[model samples]
Target: MVSFQQESDGDPASKPWYELGSAKHQGTEVTMARILQEQYPSHSLVLAHDVLYTTYTRFSILSMPGVEVELVSKPDLVVNNSFKALPRSAFVGTPGGDNVSAELVPSVEYGGFKLTWKDRHFLLYIVHFARGLSTNTQFFLLHDGPEEPSHQLLLAAGSYQNELHDEIWQFVDGFWQKSSGLWKDIQSANWDDIILESDFKAAVKKDVYGFFESRDMYKRFKIPWRRGIIMHGPPGNGKTISVKAIMKDCSVMGYTPLYVKTFKNFRGDEYAIQAIFDKARDTAPSVIVLEDLDSHITEQNRSYFLNQIDGIGGNNGILVLGTTNHFERLDPALSTRPSRFDRKFLFDDPDRPSRRLYVKYWQDQLAGSEDISFPEALAEEIADSTGKFSFAYLKEVFVSSLVSLLKEREEGHDVSFARCVREEIATLRKQLDKPQGPEVARNSQLAMVH
Candidate 1:
């Protein structure tokens, strides 16, 4: 394979290719940038920047605003312009470096399309707008070198399939609706320092007050009376539990809880979400729970999601309670919106007060037994033991430890709180030794202490 790039010595703009009628393209290289700018106006195009001198000449013509065409290929063949007009040698130092077993192969077809390969051939895809446009383009080289590209092809196909699914979603983002049946009677309480953290309790009070007060002020302006709260944390740290507790608190303060998910179990059935939001708007005093928010709406769906949230035909009286493990990955525009999430709370593991409360709660649940009694020092130990254990893990710790103790007792051995604590510590010690799995360790620690 030989490659050639036309270059003028004096000026680039004076080149023959730059002339409107001099160098004409035989077939349209698909004006993707123009298509994206005209069609998907919301997204911007990002070009792949891996191609070199020879490759740039062909793709550069297609580059435009909000559109970037990049050639994802290897630089295996070093062109020596000796005899051939397109002076590039393919056989002798092929793109196949020491990392790959396959040799470099080059071919030309499809209106001057060149295929240069090291591990496998990477066909150039002209990307118009870069907002998660899925295509049947395979990514061969993952960790520097490449092996067989069968897996890469599979991944590309899967990605394209997902892209097709996303295209269907753009249509559904226009309207606003919600279901009234989504509301559930939540049980909330003014828990002691043990059951609830100070910051959490403080946020609850602030949001509850803000909701009513803000409504009175916004009524004059005709803006819907609504607010949003974003709760983010590691998994099993009791995000769901905190939501349940928060909903209960909201109900006690004379508010209803409306729960919503982005998608239903069945495909293309998002009417439930719309219906729920509609009810929340009509219900006046309602708190909406949108669990796993990141999963439901991501950066890819930002424009559509924003349309539903604050775009035309939006909802009011809806306090969106969203939970996510990865808050940083959320769309920047969504986070920046004051109307979207006015209050953002991050749920870390239970501190000393929370740990003590969990222990007390578990002890009360197992109160009939004379063998286990809650100790103050044991509370501190459990608190220390649960470095990042969530309330969910704390409950599991109690259950696992109690079950282990009951088994030992049935086997004719005396089991006490001391034994349970020891068993819990031993479990943590074992987890600390493992090479992977922190969630498992955290859960183990929670079971041991709580």
Candidate 2:
């Protein structure tokens, strides 16, 4: 609603049209003024909230490309130019009155961004200063009642001249620039990347080649090409190491591996969570690694998660992969469909062949120049003797042996292979026999295996 008050100069009822008090409205009167402006063809200017005056003037000039912005801070200043002409004394300050209250027109106040325009149809680019996700620029069409205007009208809006702060704009702009760059980084990442351990090299070649063949067949048959894999095992197994090695191998083939630790709060915030899916959609052919899956996204949360994933709508290009120590804890609904996690493989504790290879792997990594070389025969013996030792424990054994060998060499004595092997074996034996209580041991032995 627009409220109009009558005003008169001392000259009778108003001498002439130029000297008469023109139609004036308050800050909240713009929407109504816009409506009136659309109906009438004679109104030259439509005034809005005083906060938008500066923005309107600046934007109106810049959006035209070849126009210049002229500031008339005081209300009585006249403006004239070759390209655009605004009244030099157009901007009006309060006409003070003895009976009028002091609160009427002292100053302008604003909380959000302010903008303005010259013509009935003018563009506004507002920069709302904020604290969070840093949305710097906004382009909006502030039309007069969403229709064609019957006349031209000057629409002025902006904050007070002295209150124009550049620091806030700079902060918003800086954050916007940095935040936008993450999209470019995400776009540059590759999907289809997998890494395999040196021992699994042959199996990986056959597995991946066959994996691609199945994928091709799915596409040929117009099937949803999604695959899930379950890599489950005891703690300290090669599950993590195998994933890392696979990442390294996949990097060679231009796969960009993104590791997501699926804890309680995987998504940062609502916007950030949406952004992850947005980036996924934008940057397809990528691998998303959900690590440590059991702690979060299980049971009840899993259903909620499936709902969210379905809502994402365009996720076919992403290759979903995951790792977990407790596979049974995962929701059965995840693997209910055959192709969901089509390739489930166990990364059990090292068997004999794996143990022998792991021993060589670590020995080659830590052995000194004059140190006793890795004994394949000894490794075979250790592999045969230590049935419960995992690859991680073997790596620890190799490190301990190297330290022992270095100490013996410092003592100026020939290191004995038997002594080193004995020390490593003793450590392994202790780890193997470290007692859980009788009850816990019994439960561990009978724990359900999935």
The true-versus-predicted C-alpha distance at residue 445 of model 2, in Å, is 20
Residue 137's lDDT in candidate 2: 24
Worst ten in a row by lDDT for model 2: 167-176
Report RMSD (Å) for each prediction in the order shown.
19.8, 17.5
lDDT of 2 by residue, 1-450 (tens): 212122233211112211222344332233333443453333343232223212222223233432233321223222222232324444344567333222221211111111233333332222222223321222232343433331222222222221222111101111111122222333333322212234444453344334434666878887665445556667777566555554444434444444453332323233333444454455444455555656646454565556545544666555556677877777776544444555555566555565666666555654675546656677677666656676667666767777887788789988776578668878777867843222212211112232
Stretches > 4 Å off in candidate 1? 1-194, 220-224, 249-254, 264-276, 363-368, 428-450
Clash count per candidate: 12, 21
Error of 1 at 66 (Å): 64
lDDT of each: 0.50, 0.44
lDDT at position 419, candidate 1: 72
lDDT of 1: 0.50
